[model samples]
Target: MTSSPAAPGSRLASRLGFSDRVFIGRAARRVADQIEAGLDLVENGLAEDLRVADSVADAASRYLYEAGGKRIRPVLALLTAQLGEGNIPAVIDIAKALEMTHLGSLYHDDVMDGADRRRGVPAAHAVWGNSVAILTGDILFSRASQLMSRYGDRAIRLQADTFERLVMGQLHETVGAQPGDDPIEFYINVLADKTGSLIAAATQGGAIFSNAPAEYVEPLRLYGEKVGVAFQLLDDVIDLSAKPEETGKVPGTDLRAGVPTMPYLLLKTETDAASAALAVQIDEGVARIADGEDPAILDQPLAELRDHVVTQKTLELARTWTRDAIDALAPLPKGTVREALTRFAESLADRSS
Candidate 1:
């Protein structure tokens, strides 16, 4: 197995934990040189794309990128690109564009969620105000499109489709489930659209832009989408499980914001008196937080919910989706890339981030 260049138990290594990081190292070791090169290319290219003549716009656009991230999306793009010639110029450009799209969405998400911190720092909106943050997000989106444009009509179409899904997901979240809608199904679809679409694009872009086989495209897309859903589902659990120091945010941040998560949704499905009472408390807690009250007020009920049977159910379901993501890769040729993709999917489900 290939060892990570990161020092053991360092912030980067700890991000995935020792064993989980081992899985990733093993998968990508064969293509380690390419992965490292692709990562550097993405980092440099992303910074350049964020730069603009307007100093404010330039600074705003680079905010989240500068804060640093797991770089999951770009890394996935680079990994899949290995199925072809590996780290081609087009693949690097695609990776940079996709990362920009992701960073742009986070700015808008923080504003909508009223989040105070991101990546352990004040959220963009908190620092720059909502208008500036929103406009900055728009600027990144436009910049991503400009990058996509170089790859011709096909890439442009993919970008447009992914953007639409992202907007629709956010809109659906804002409007919430209609009276008769199944909340669980609706939530899953939202996860798919909001988190899954861009990941799907990243995987598909890697293969397509790298000139990998056309047949590999659909399977990779499916894999990417499922991995995205699994990733979000894991985040749902992590929202409840992680310590603030580990995640760079307080536990139950989403729950306090009245955002539906798998655990809460599962808890809602119960009819037992204890579950019913806790759900009510959860709803009340969300309302209090929405009114600008502290989330710590709900610590007792949040702890109860975190330890509930339904929360375990949510975790099990996340693992199921992660497995399905791996299954989706069955059509791909078996090699280092496929193994790495499988490891990556499993690692995502297992992560605190």
Candidate 2:
């Protein structure tokens, strides 16, 4: 199930023609391969230390490790590290740590978001229940931190800071859900803390691994931040636009949860007074769905509102962030890694999930 990295020239060419299915198919396979390498590092590295623990813990760890993810953050770290001469082992260890942290967050996030499925299967919480899921996430987080501590690399501080940002981002989203906050600002801040922080970690961790200059670190950080925002925006857009079969989740889950996302905020901004009133009604209807009311009741209004506003605006915002992300990488050296990352940024806008 492990993915392999594509050849450099092929990867670069794929980026140049990202919209082409043939090119994208190859590029995705390459990304998947690189991600699998990092996941293997995380799995084997942790197994060596934790295999003697209780069978439940061991099983939970194995289940999570096998359930595969995009491994975007680790790939970012690995590719960025390749920009400078460095010990590959150390770079990979850092990449593994980042993936561990990310998967840990996803575990907790599924619990918090009440998600039923992930990677097209039952979520950790669904398989093991909340308490075990929570504990599993804690174990992963601790293990990731422990790896950094044992490695005693200077990048440990950066990893620690990224963890703090992740927590802060979760808190920001929770608070933003309270009455009276501007939805747009809430989403922006949430994205900054939740998505941007890890991306920043990936870039900074890469720079630290390679002992890259501070000037180089700063642009990479910016690139990660912008790309992270673009990534999240696309995620929200796909949630609304993609089929549930493709995304492996119910569409409009955010709207149903009464969570204010970029699309919802844009809908609010674009609607006139009458439509705004109708929008509120739709919001209330969606909120009722969140409260366990059957979603079938909101179908008509939701469809009308979506057609009137949300979808188009979300796409437009995604494109804007993609451009911003590309610009952020302009200061970096022109190479295959940079080209691949830039192509990945553009792909965000068109992602199905």
Q: Against the true structure, whose TM-score is highest?
A: 1
lDDT of 2 by residue, 1-353 (tens): 23223323223233322334322456455644554455456446644643427888877765665555555676577667656654366777787778788888888998998988876568899989999989988888887787677557566787788899999999888766558877787787789889988987887677677666666787788888877887788777766653678775566677677676776677777647867875787788877887889976666665565566666777777788779878887778766556766777766766743
User: In lDDT terms, which candidate is top?
Assistant: 1
Taking the candidates one at a time, how many backbone clashes does each contain?
A: 0, 2
Model 1 lDDT vs. the true structure?
A: 0.84
State each model's CA lDDT, in order: 0.84, 0.70
Candidate 2's C-alpha runs over 4 A off are 1-52, 151-153, 177-181
Error of 2 at 298 (Å): 2.5
On the 0 to 100 scale, the lDDT of residue 293 in model 2 is 93
Q: Give, for candidate 1, the lowest lDDT window spanning 10 residues.
A: 1-10
Note each model's CA RMSD in angstroms: 4.0, 4.7
